[model samples]
Target: MDLFDAINQRHSYRGPLLADPVPRTDLRRIIQAGLQAPSGRNAQTTEFIIIDDPVLLAKLQAMHPANQAMQQAPAMIACLIDRQPAAVYEGYNFQIEDCAAAVENMLLAITALGYASVWIDGWLRLEQRADRVAQLLMLPTDKKLQILLPIGRPAEHWPQKERKPFAQRAWFNCYGAEETPCQ
Candidate 1:
């Protein structure tokens, strides 16, 4: 699929994923797309840990009680942010912004590659869930787990989610000025 089509079609998939294994080449391509996202001051604090091992996947599934998507997904990408003091830019931490960009890029790539995934955040960020997940992945102390993406073929077809009308959410020049819809 083309970039525009991929963007339009991409949705958060929380349903079951097929049992088929995702090829390593495709996984690498998806990761590459994420790495290409722009970073703040070239801090490049975003890191990814690809999980495909069945045993490890099972462990991860057990770790996240609120989410079952990982239980069936053939592969997952753990988005991490390096929180070292030196990783900051302009006296601010851009880990969230940087990682979000990477996640969006990977989501589009996943769509283009004929697969589905969900950008999981809140579930992993609750309480000490992320910390436990980081431990399961054996991530270092400085590496903070921010999001998880489960990748695989969807077991059931899903339609794009309904979005707010352009006019309701967007404006021309000012915050509440004349509405200007995208062409």
Candidate 2:
């Protein structure tokens, strides 16, 4: 699919997913897209662990029992982030920004590949779920699980989410300015 189409089609797929496993090749392609994302100061703080094993998937499903998408997804991607990342721009680290960029890229890729996924962050933030996930993955202490994406084919179709009009959400030269700017 075209980039714009993928971007338009990409939604947080919270519905149940099919049981079919996402091929490793497609997973690699998705991750490659994420790797190609521009990191803040090129810190490239994002790392990934693709989970396709049924046992691990089952464990994750149990962890998020209330979420049908999490339970039915045939595969998942865990995005790991560096805690004490070297400040590449100023004195502050941009690990979160880097991870977000990478995730967006991967989401687009997933949509293009005919797969569906949801950016699962808020749920993981509650009750130390992310820490437990990191432990299950045997991730290093320095690497924290910042994001999780459950991926598979959707069992049902969902409508594209409505986007705000450009005039309301964006402007030209100045904040809240008209798109064309002064003549």
Candidate 3:
């Protein structure tokens, strides 16, 4: 799919995914897209753990009860961030921003490749889930697992949700000055 079409079609797919496995080559391509994302000061604090092992996926599913999508996905990508201070300014860590950019890139790639996925982050922040996931992946103390992307074909199609009108959400020159929508 074209870049603009992929962007327009991409949606959070929380429903079950098809049973077919995602090819390793496609997974690599998706990860490459994420790795190419621009990072703050080129710190590149983001890392990925591509999980396709059935046993491992089952364990992760057990750990995150709310992540039903992960349970059915043929493959998943765990997005990790290095907590070690890198490109820090005024005691602010840019790892979150760096990882977020990477995730967005991967999401776009997933859509372009005719696959479906959802950015799984909120569950990682709840009930010590991140800590448990980190332990399951046996990550080093400095590496933190922050997000997951379950990749596969959607079991059912969902219509794209409507977005706020461009004119209502965007402006030009000054805040709320020009309500003209982008062409």
Candidate 4:
């Protein structure tokens, strides 16, 4: 798919996924897209762990008792950020921003590559799930699991959610002052 199409199609897929496994090669490509994302001060504080093992998948699945997508995804990517990231520029650690950029890139890549995934961050934040996942993956104390993406072929289809008009959300010269903004 082209870049625009990927951007348009990339949505949070919370539905069940097909049982077919996602190839390691594709997973690598997806993660590579994330790695290419621009980081604040080029700190590049985000790291990733790709998981495809059935045993481990089962363990992760158990964490999300209500999310079918989490249970059925054939693969997953864990975004890790430094727990105590050193300030790279302006005494600011951009791990969170870097991680978000990376996740968005990966989500687009996932759409472009004919796979689907959901950004599973909030759920991970609940119930100390991120900590558990970090422990499960044997991450170092410096690293914390910041995001999780469940990857697989979607079992069901859903319409892309509508987005608000550009005119309402954006403006040419100032904030929300466009009587008629050019597209």
Candidate 5:
């Protein structure tokens, strides 16, 4: 598929995901796309924990309170970053931003490959929970969990969501200034 089609077709599939396993080659390609994302100061801190093992997936599902759909996913990706490199930031760490960009790229690539995916954000901010997940994944001591993404083929229909007009959400040089209206 073309880039435009991928962007337009991408959506957070929340219903059910097919049980068919995602090929490791495809997963590697998706992760490679993520790695292509830009990094701050060339730190290249983004790390990916691609989990296709059913037992491990179940372990991660147990971490959630009531996310049954997680088990339906054939595979999931845990986006992470090594803080040792990110710590070089003077005040703020851009690891989260960098990893998030990588995740978005992966999501787009998943869509392009005729697959479905959803962003799992809350998993990264829970109290001591993310730390446990990191340990479970055997991540490096300096690595920190950022986000998770469950990917698979869609088992249910997912229609495109409505979006606001460009004029309302866009500005030329400042917020609240409608510089370019949708035509």
Candidate 6:
């Protein structure tokens, strides 16, 4: 599918993914797509840790709450940032922005490849718990774990989510005013 088609078709997938392993080549392609996303000052701070080992995946899955579906995913990605880079700037973490864009690109690519994915933020953790997760991953004390993404072939079909009419969400050169769906 073309870029536009991929964008339109992409959505969050939290259901079961096929047990089949994602091909290394395809995984590389997904990572490449992420790298292609724009970065802050070209900082390109995002880093990806793709986890496929069942044992390791199992361990990580155990760290979370009752999310059986997470254990079933054939692949998972840990989006992280180097604190050193972000520290160079005051109140700016380019890695988070960079990785987020990267993940968005990968999510779109996943749909294009007839797969599914979900963005599971690690933000649900309290400070202490979040720190534990970082320790488990052996990330530096300064580095941060942005999110965990589970990806695979969806076991069930899902429809597009409901949304407010475009008119209600858009505006004309101002906040909350007249604007048509097509502009």
lDDT of 3 by residue, 91-110 (tens): 67788898999999999999
Candidate 1 structure quality by residue, lDDT tens digits, 1-183 = 889999999998888888999999999999999999988888877899999999998888776555546678889999998757464556787878989999999999999999999888888777788898899999999788999999999888888999998878878877766756445
Candidate 1 is scored at a TM of 0.92
Question: Model 4 — TM-score against the truth?
Answer: 0.96
lDDT of 6 at 6: 83
TM-score result, candidate 6: 0.83
Candidates' C-alpha lDDT: 0.87, 0.92, 0.87, 0.91, 0.83, 0.75
Clashes of each: 0, 0, 0, 0, 0, 0
Model 2 per-residue lDDT tens digits across residues 147-183: 9999999999997889999889877788888756755
Give lDDT tens digits, candidate 4, residues 1-183: 999999999898899899999999999999999999999988788999999999999999988978888989899999999998899887878889999999999999999998989989888888888999998999998899999999999989876899998977977766777676545
- lDDT tens readout by residue for model 6, 41-138: 78888887787888787777776545545767778877777757644366665676788899999888888888788887744355565566677678
TM-score for each prediction? 0.92, 0.96, 0.92, 0.96, 0.87, 0.83
For residues 29-59, write the lDDT of model 5, one tens digit per residue. 9999999988777677788889999999888
Stretches off by above 4 angstroms in model 2 are 179-183
Instruction: For model 2, name the residue pairs that clash.
Output: none
Clashing pairs in 5: none
Candidate scoring better on TM-score of 3 and 6: 3
Give the runs in model 3 whose Cα sits over 4 Å from its true position.
Answer: 88-92, 179-183
How does residue 65 of candidate 3 score in lDDT? 57
